[model samples]
Target chain A: MAIPFSYSLRNLWTRRLTTVLTASGMALVVFVFAATLMLAEGLRKTLVETGSYDNVVVIRKSANSEVQSGVDRAQASIIESQPEVARGTDGRLLLAKELVVLINIPKRESNKPANVVIRGISPASLLLRPQVRLSEGRMPRPGSAEVIAGKSIARRFKGGGIGETLRFGMRDWTVVGIFDAGTTGFSSEIWGDVDQLMQAFRRPAYSSVSFKLQDVTAFDQFKKRVEGDPRLTVEAKRETRYYEDQSEAMAKFLRIMGITLTVIFSLGAVIGAMITMYAAVANRVVEIGTLRALGFQKMSILAAFVMESLLLGLLGGVAGLSGASFMQLITISTMNWQTFSELAFSFTLTLDILWKSLLFSVGMGFVGGVLPAFRAARMNIVEALRSS
Target chain B: MGMGNGKPPIVEIAHLSKSYRRGSQTIPVLEDITFDIADGEFLALMGPSGSGKSTLLNLIAGIDKADEGTIRVGGVDITSLSERELAAWRAANVGFIFQFYNLMPVLTAFENVELPLLLTGLSRNERREHVELALQLVGLSDRVDHYPAQLSGGQQQRVAIARAVVSDPAILVADEPTGDLDRVSAGEILQLMDRLVREFDKTIIMVTHDPRAAEKARIIRHLEKGILTDSDGQPASPVAGS
Candidate 1:
């Protein structure tokens, strides 16, 4: 004979205070778990979605990121003249020499200084990234001391939005525009005319040169041709792969942190569930005895209690995931380890992350409830019946 | 009345001896007891504290194992049955009532009554019908939806009785059923037990310290120390003192 599900449900409901308290504690653990995964997901999305697979970036030999690489104008010109480089509508190579540097800027509320990446890009750079769009104002003119800030940066730094002025190295630059890069890494950078920025910062060489290849298949040939020439000691890689490699160390660090914290938090939640289930069994001794006397198998009693705990865990998982989804409303700024500059990212709650969090919650419930359920099943009917 | 055909007794016990091990010594509880209960016989077991009356009832109810014995209940050798088999047999043939009316506090009267039926092969609708009939028999039809906490002690005991009889087991074993109730409640409980035994024709074996409660049974057996003595209107040697 089967025990009705309503019996377990009603029993849980009868102890509403304990049920809710245990569930909420589990919810807090799940929330932290989901948030950590979202942080990792946001980091991955920022790097993976920022560049195209067909586009190739040329940098100085042995350099990993644009901030560490420097290519002179002559070398940039030589790379742009390659036969495998794609041509724009103007019948010229689709190549851009860009500058990447970091400057310390004051935060909006606390006035505490944070390092922010300032990118100097040519007009061709805008053509290279069609996803970039100005959300607030017009793009700055070529020769003017004006800059456009990424949407995320605009929210984090003082004098970052349109119409504000920011001082950088004794020169005041006007914030003329605000742009969005569709939630990618570019959303954390500041853009201006390459030549003007290079003059202001006294940088003679560009950080890196980016260009679209004639055919993705020609990438290997292009890399071979560029590296084979000792006259130009350079490295060429697909921009997407480049950004992927750049994010690997940080992604690994985030994954470790997420898993470690989730384990710790899940331990606390499991302990909470154990305490609640133990109390439930203790209080329902007579009820269990009646069940035994009524001929319910010990396995059934164990299964029923474990199922109740699982239901509670599932409730907590749903709540935590729902709360994490709302975190997209906030914008966070943290220093990018590779560039030592603040990179703005938002919380992302993907379906995969939500499902994983739910599975984790259920596991916690099962692990925590088993001992108590065993104790309940092993109770002596006579002793249990005698219990007040 | 139809005993001329020599049908097997519903309950049979032979040389049943039960003891508990206390440290290094074996303390005997029921020493070489023998008894038989015919089908539909309303028997009561009366004894003082430490008289092994409840222990005998537990052994017959399949809740405990005897140290040495053969116990046949409803024509099945219960003493030889495994723990799992005994539980199934008990579910099908034996009903139990405790002193405190141990109804699940979270369940309503109807759900509590429906519990034993869950161990049966009956469908939900059939279970509902049986539960309804049982509750009706106990006069708790109006209190089916009320929790145990909301009912009086007597009503709770009635619900317990309904639960015990819901599965329609062949025999019922009650231990101090009215021990926790007041005089009026106890009287009502005794009357209900009498109706079950007379109308339902159930083989009832009850343990009680109250002689008034025992008076409702057709035959009352007394236990002193660990020995059983017949007290069914017949002269018997005084136990232990003789």
Candidate 2:
């Protein structure tokens, strides 16, 4: 027959100091574990939300990012002339042959220089991304030196406020507006007229050409046609697929970092739990013997000890998760590893992360408790009773 | 053979031997011991320190396996049973009382008494009733909620006794039940044990070093240097003709 759960519970309560200390160790490890996963999840969410599925991006075949790709004006025109490209309300092609470049901007608080993306857009560029909206002031005028700063850049970068002037490519540009891109990577960029930027930077080739599809389902045919054309040296990709690829390297790095930190920290926590459990077994040898004589099987004793450790782990898990949930209130920035541009996002906690962290803590507890529990269960009843 | 009530004995041991190995030395603790105790008999095993009396008691209670022998308690050969079966059999038939009370310090007196009943398939209410009755029998009904540390030494032993008999097992084995108690508490514990024999008709096998404690038993068997002896200190094989 199994021992009552109350037995294990009270035993833990009886040693409250050790219980708290061990649980606190586990809590710290779980906190780091959960926070790292949240960081990775937030990064992935920001990049993924930056793109719309119906839009396609055409870049140089071997280029990994827009900053590295170049599409000449002729190629941009050919892509824009495709029959599958959508038309705007003004009967103009719903496409933007954009130029992307990076410049060092000093952070407002630290004055530390960080790489920020400078995107020069056509008039249709803002229309293609419906998620972006002017939260303050007005949009940048076409073919002018005026620029619009994303909300993140406006808040974090020096000379990024409305009406402020920023010097790049030997010309002063005015920040006319601040646009919020709602958790998307676009919020980390500065947008201006493509022709003006191209003249200032002396660039002859557009970095990439983006176009909305008239029919989303015809994307496969359009991609095959673009890739097969002898005149085109570009590859076409759905915007969503492009952004998802952008998130892959950064997400993988975050996961590896989280696993490494959690492993190192959890080793210490598990050892702490092991010490606590071994002490409990040593102190309760006589009690175990008495239980054995009273008819509790070895399995029952093993289960009781393991249950106690699992409870300890559950306590830590809940505490760590609560600590991590509050991290959603914090917005932090880090360099996007793939694009080398500063991106801002908050820690995002999902139901999946919650359950996985809890399961991880409980697994740590099991590893810590099993050996000591075996020692307790495998004790000789005669020798144990005689210990007293 | 039928010393107590002329009925069949509840516990029978034959050719029982046990030893311990210490760095290649085989130290015999119990050797070829044979004995029997009739139903409702209160038997005490008395000896000096290191005389192996407790080992014999453990064997009879099915808490320890014999090296080369058979032990039949309540007509079932316990030595023939596997470890799992022995555990179930012990739960169903054998109760144990320890010298230091061995009460779980974190549990209340009522909870301590309720432990053995948890192994049974009794419902919660049924277990509570059984626990209350056992506490009432031990005169600890007023202190049922008190932890072991809150109770006196004598009260703790009484609680231990209630725990032992709560399941109504066929045999109760106590090792020096009063060895850790004061004289007055020891006297009280002995009187309670004697009452269990006359009133509850329990078959008890107790191992103690106290002569006064042995005097309370219906029959006292002596053990010296791993061998059973009569009162006159001679090697005795009285019951099983071994």
Candidate 3:
């Protein structure tokens, strides 16, 4: 007959100090694992959330990012005139012909220069992306030199605050507004008047054209039409797919790095668990013999010890995940490999991450406990009872 | 061999033998030891240290295997049973008591007694009733919630006895049940074992070196040099008590 479940649980409780010490070691590994996963997830979420599913982004066929794309006025106009393009409330096409470039900026604290994205946009830019909201002051007017900074840029960079003037493009540009783009890539950019920026930089075509589609499902036909058009040398892609592509390289790198670090650290954690379990078996020899004499079979003894280790994993998982959740409040900045710009994002915790981390912890416990549990099960009852 | 009462033996051993190997040296522990324990009998096997008394007890309890014989207990040849089947048989038919009063320190007296019943198909309420009755029989019903450390030596041994009998197994095997106890506590334990045979009709086989412990049993035997010491290889008569 199988031993009762409480037998294992109470045995763990009886060795409270060992349980805490071993669990804490496991908790440290889980914390590293969960935090690394959260970093990758956060970076991916920031970029993927920047795009709308029903919107299509038109860019140069050879360009991988908006900064690398170029659309001349003729090409922009031809793309905007498509019948499948959604119209705005004012009866104008809901299209934005934007120009994107890279500029170096100094941080407020470290004073180290970093590459930042400077985007020149039309009035339809705000109309296309509904996620961006003006948190302070007003949007920059058309045909003016005023620019707006994202909330992240305003908080971290020098001369990025509202009403401050930043010298860029050989001209003094006033930061008139500060906008918040919740957990999206746009929060790492500076936006200004497209015409003024083009004139200031000189000899530049639009970087890309983004527009809302009339029917989301018509994207296949629209992509074929745009790619087939002789007058245009551009490709049409869903904005969601575009942003997802932008997030892919950096997210993959983060996940690989995270997994490597966690794998190395988990070895130590698993070893710690093994030592703890072996010690437990050594200490409970007589108790195990008594149990055997009481007619608990070898399998029951094995299961009881394994259950104790599993409980350790359970406690460790909860502790590690609890620690990772607090990381959501910390915003960190790093270089984005896709666009060669500084991007800021928080460590985000998701339901999938939660479950996977917990399972990983339990897996560590299982691997760590198996050998010791076998030792416990294979013990001779005579010897076990003989040991006081 | 049949006993005088004509009641079939609860534990029957014929030509039983066992040996141990210590790093390439074969040490015989019990050789050609044979006996039969009848129903409702209290028997004791006594010897000095390292005389195989405990090994003999363990063999009859199905905790160890015998090399050269057949042991039929409750009409089944236990010597032929597989390890897994022996485990099941031991759970169903054997109860055990140990010298150190090996109650689980983490479990309360009541919980410790309720342990063996967890293997049975008995419901929770039924198990509780059985555990309560066992504790009551040991006259420690009030100590059910107490931990083993909180109880005295005699009380702890009584708790162990309660745990042993809680499952109502066919036979109870005890190894040095009073070896760690004071004389007063040991006497109390012997009286309790005697009461179990008289009142609950339990069949008990205890291994010890104490003459007072052997006197409590109806039939007593001696072991020496891995063999039974009686010339005819039968149990000697019960010792006259002081």
Share of native interface contacts present in candidate 3: 0.68
C-alpha positional error of residue A123 in candidate 2 after TM-score superposition, expressed in Å? 1.7
Which candidate number would show the highest DockQ if scored against the true structure? 2
How good is model 1 by TM-score? 0.93
User: For candidate 1 chain B, which ten residues in a row score worst on lDDT?
Assistant: B233-242
Over the stretch A1-388, how does candidate 2's per-residue lDDT look in tens digits?
7888999999888999999989999999999999999999999999999999999999999899998999999988889889999999999889999999998889999999999999999988988999999999898777789999999999999999998988797888999999999999999999999999999999999999998999999899999999999999999999999998998999899999999989999999999999999999999999999898887999999999999999888888888889889999999999888889999998999999999999999998899999999999999998898898
lDDT on C-alpha atoms for all candidate structures: 0.85, 0.91, 0.89
DockQ of each: 0.60, 0.83, 0.69
- Angstrom error of the Cα, residue A145, model 3: value is 1.5
- Give per-residue CA lDDT, model 3, range A1-388, as digits (tens): 6777887788788888988989898898889889989999999899999999999999999799987889999999898888889998889888899999899989999999999999998888988999999999999988888999999999999999998988888999999999999999899999999999999889369999999998989999999989999999999889999989988998888889888988888888889899999999999899998888777889999998898889888889999999999999999999988889999998999999999999989988988898999999999988899998
Q: Is 1 or 2 the stronger prediction by lDDT?
A: 2
lDDT of 1 by residue, A1-388 (tens): 6567787788789888988888888888888888878887787778878888888999999998899999998888888789888888998678888999889899898999998888999777877888888899889899999999998878878999889988895699999999989877898889988889999999999999999888889999999989898778789989999888877778778878989988998899999999998988888888787787778888888988898788878877888888888987876767778878777777888899989999988888888889999999888876777685
**Model 3 chain A: ten consecutive residues of lowest lDDT:** A1-10
Q: How close is candidate 3 to the true structure, as a TM-score?
A: 0.96
Q: How accurate is candidate 1 locally (lDDT)?
A: 0.85
- Please give me the DockQ of candidate 1 compared with the native complex: 0.60
Query: What TM-score did chain B of candidate 2 earn?
Result: 0.96
Would you list the clashing residue pairs of candidate 3? none
